[model samples]
Target: MWSRIRRAGRVTALVLPCSLLALAASQSAQAALGSAPLTPPSDASVSSRVVQPASGTTQSVMRSESSAASSTSSTSASYTVRETTFGNGTVVREYLTTSGAVFGISWHGPQMPDLNDLLGSYFPQYVAGVKAVRAARGNARGPVSVDDSGLVVRSGGHMGAFSGVAWLPSELPAGVSGSDIQ
Candidate 1:
């Protein structure tokens, strides 16, 4: 009887840690829109990462201009984009303001990243927006668009290829616009 008890205790010891780790992993590990993170989490293997620092006080976010981004301007109202390409071929980009607040997120690839993880606190808003769309149109058959409560999410794609973007209008940094999220 003592041996059985000891065996059960050992099993519990092994299972408890594994279960805790799984729970932690299952939790939302992303810090997005309206918030900042110490180091954003990524479940999938990262193939590459690129950090685009803020340029000077430009009229707009000129992502196409590498030289502009390379320049330093303390007065720049521009932003930074930390792009991560995962092993699955999906690329997720987080747009952060000078204060480190994540104002926007965009993703594109053969498979869609988990939006719940990406949106974090804003997932409920996205769900409500989807419900509203369904109620108005009878069906949100294709493309997901949520334009309410200062949150604008535009996402749509077919099988094997998907892309989407979400941003907080109020959180957008100076001189940034919808076009900058991409």
Candidate 2:
């Protein structure tokens, strides 16, 4: 009985440290999710600017303009797309409408870009909507969408290749539709 008690105590000691480590890691990740700085959206010209720092490249975010294609124009409006590549091979593209509002944003890669940064002030609403939908559907598969009169957000991705888009519906240019965002 004494040998069994010692064996159990050793197992408990190992498990306690592992559990504490996992808890700390999760807390840090949650904090990091909302720690990215916010960038003001632009309306007129097409210019590529670093809106979100690519993962693992936080120090040189403003200087990492080489990953993006320059802004382009069309008959109705202009857009700037900034592509930031992460260490894990994810590429995030933020699309701004001519009015300077972020009409659309997309991500494709091994990990999803932080929505708290991409969604800006609207992240809370998106989170609430998602919670409601999940509660209602109880395990809904496929894409998640939050549609409001002023804002719209859609996100869906699996494992290593996740992707999502969010847009300000009212800020979309005259000739631009949500489908035109991607």
Candidate 3:
């Protein structure tokens, strides 16, 4: 009777492992079917320049431009530094740029959870969509133009909001156009 009990225990342990493995496999399969793949990072560098407001100036931000275009003719590259209000009511100074062809996006905002977390989640998708647009359009001889048409949300809070920027030399694919959103 004791040997019979021992044999039963060994069999149960083996079965438990196999059951767990099957469960894990099913969960992974469900994830693959239920969601899209995560976006990858863009291949552009970001730089920051700071300016101080005059002692009694009510102006919130100062603007400066330095024309340094990337070597790629297919890419439109530009940088802007602005003071903007974030979703959590925190005001932040940020610098962002995009390499036209590659659609590289990077920003620095307040250290708060709302600002940082929103950018972290939304940026990847934004870059991915931009890259897709670029790839579909093919090559252009000049920088792509982006127009700030106001903010639209993609996920959480106002942080996911994005302005519609036009890409110039609209080399949109055979069936695509600049008005279409990816």
lDDT of each: 0.66, 0.53, 0.28
> Roughly what TM-score does model 3 have, to 2 decimal places?
0.19
* TM-scores for the candidates: 0.65, 0.58, 0.19
Model 2 agreement with the true structure over 1-182: per-residue lDDT tens digits:
01222464463332335665554333211111112222322211212542221231211123222222222222233454444555445566566543334567766777666677677677888988888778789867677988877667788978887887777777665555677555
- Stretches of candidate 2 above 4 Å error? 1-77, 139-142
Query: Where does candidate 3 clash, by residue pair?
Result: 75-101, 76-100, 147-165, 147-166
Candidate 3 on 21-86: residue-level lDDT in tens? Answer: 554333211101011211211221223332222222222222222232222121222322233333
List candidate 3 stretches off by more than 4 Å.
1-92, 95-118, 139-182
lDDT of 3 at 14: 25
Indicate the TM-score of model 1. 0.65
Task: Give candidate 2's TM-score.
Answer: 0.58
- N/CA/C clash count, model 2: 4
> Which portions of model 1 show Cα errors greater than 4 Å?
1-29, 37-77
lDDT digits (tens) for residues 32-132 of candidate 1: 66676313345443221223334433333333223333422324435666566655567787776655567888889887777877787888999999888
Error of 2 at 20 (Å): 18
Candidates sorted by lDDT, descending order? Answer: 1, 2, 3
